[model samples]
Target: MLSVQLFHNFNKYARITEADFGLIEQVLSKKFVKKRRTLLSEGDKSRYIYFVEKGALRSFTVDKDGVEHVIQLAIEEHWIADLYSFVTKAAGNINIEAIEDSEVWLLPHHELELLYEQIPALERYFRQLFQRAYVSLQQRLNLTVSSNAEDRYRQLLQDFPQIAARIPLIYIASFLGITPESLSRIRKQLFQ
Candidate 1:
């Protein structure tokens, strides 16, 4: 299952041979996490980048007032990691937790480097992944600055309808940078 999704994700950026797929698979380790389990905590060093095979995970940060801000959400076939920590071996400021019972495949930093050397095309694949992530982040920043709260919630619904169905509304509200009551009012207006 994970192999199929992994190969699909890799092939999106580059052509991968069976041998290449096998090589990539060899470096991956599978993990299952229950809902609410924390995979990576704030201030912890990130050791592995995870690819979701099933369920959902969220990355977030807690502010001084203890308000949690959702930064990213990864579902099936998506990748999740504290990229800063994973790349620099520094403490991560974000925490990643399972929003549902999840199955994931992890690639350790060492093995990822080895795989890049062994399978050079993998480097291109990863580069493409980073590029897309950067673009997404930029788009999110633009949306946050330019869009109204209702428009933001609508855009989120248009872009990731599955998120509304899969995660709690409070988390979705946090991700949209709006209060739950505000989101409720927006939803009522939209539906009415």
Candidate 2:
């Protein structure tokens, strides 16, 4: 059975009538991922977009130095994907993995294309998702370039309040482009 939350999320972007939504429910498959399991590895073809049904997942990249940079943290109701690879049919540089045991709904790209034509409203939902993802990318770029580490950390807390407690501190530090020790100091300063 499909989740009501997913249905609500879909309707949030575009209306899907009861009958039309059944078309969607038919195509999405569910997968349960264990903690630390990789969903999409770097250099793999991005074949699917996942909607988090329960628990957490993260998308990140490993640098030449072997340092990981967290790109996005996805929790319940969040959609995670390497859109660039998905759209271009190119190999993806991003890696996605479960941070905790998780249940996710998968929407395969090939199926999505057929759904777009069959359910025109689905296109608008995906379009808004991509637009939001792009805006988030642009905003993060602007914030990273113009802000200090402390400011960046502060903004992160403000934007994703659940992240600090739900995700590991190390990943948060990586996302902020700072050492874990630096994050500890920032937390101390903010709290005390």
Candidate 3:
């Protein structure tokens, strides 16, 4: 079931042999998470980088006041992880949770290191993936700093087309760094 997409995703970054891909398939484990499931809780050292195959997930942090500030959102075909914890083996500050019932492909970081040596192309593929993730994070930070709330909201919709419909507005407000009431106002204004 996950065959074509996984293989296609790897080949999109680098030409991979079937034998090499078979190794990757062996290490990957799939699971279905119900909505609101927490894949990685805050303070946990992450062992896997999850690839969303069906639904959506988000990474966020809760403030002292119990309010969540979303850091990243990953939809189908996208990857999500607490990179710092995954790479350094330290506890992570952010929590990764499912927004919808999601089918995810879990790629173990421990196996990935071995895969890199066995298949040189895999290293290139992962390197490219990390670079792109970094670039996206930087761009989001830049947008948050430079753009107004409405512009940020608009950008979110443009970046993730189904976000406004599939994701809760409160999560959207948190992602945009705005209050729920303010987001409601913005939506009202946008339609007028």
Candidate 4:
């Protein structure tokens, strides 16, 4: 099942050969997380990068005043990790929490290095993944800086429609950089 999903994800960019699939199956471990559980917390070293097999997750951080700020949302087939900590082996500054009961396929950094060494194409595959992730972060930053709350909400819906149904209004608001009441008003305005 995971192999099929991986293949589908890579189909547009590159094909995953049987050997590559075998290696991934061997090295990657699948785990389940219940809603509201933390996959990684602030100050913890990120040890694995996760690919969502089912459900959703969110990455966020708390401000000095203890206000939570959402950074990114990951749905099915999406990847999540603190790239800075994952790559640098430093403590993560953010927290990744399960938004729903989720199944995640994890690839450890060490195993990933082995994959790169054993399968040359795996490096190219991850390079493309990093490129996409970078572009996504850039776009998110641009939206947060340039767009209004309503615009951000609409764009979030456009990008991930299922999120609106699965994530709480408060979380959606946080992710959009808006207050919960403001998001409530925006939702009413959207339908009208």
Using lDDT as the measure, which candidate wins?
2
Q: Give the least accurate 10-residue stretch of model 3, judged by summed lDDT.
A: 1-10
Predicted candidate 1 versus true structure: per-residue lDDT over 8-75, tens digit per residue:
88889988888888888887899999999999999999999999989999999999999999999889
- Per-residue lDDT tens digits for candidate 2, residues 103-189, read 999999999999999999999999998999899989989988999989999998999898777999999898888999999999999
The per-prediction tally of clashing pairs is 0, 0, 0, 0
Candidate 3 pairs with clashing backbones: none
User: Per-residue alpha-carbon lDDT of model 3 for 1-192, expressed as tens digits?
Assistant: 355777888888998898898888899999899999999999999999998888989999999999899988888778899999999989999899999999999999999999999999999988999999899889989998999999988888787878678888998899889999999999999889
Question: lDDT order of candidates, best first?
Answer: 2, 1, 3, 4
Ranking of candidates on TM-score, top first: 2, 1, 3, 4
Q: Which of the predicted structures, 2 or 3, would earn the higher TM-score when compared with the native?
A: 2
lDDT of 4 by residue, 36-87 (tens): 9999999999999989989899999999999999988888888899988999
As for candidate 2, its clashing pairs are none
**2 against 4, candidate with superior TM-score:** 2
The models' CA-based lDDT, in order, is 0.91, 0.92, 0.90, 0.88
Best by the TM-score measure: 2
- Give the root-mean-square deviation of each candidate in angstroms: 1.2, 1.0, 1.3, 1.4
Off by over 4 Å in 1: none
- Tell me the TM-score of model 3: 0.94
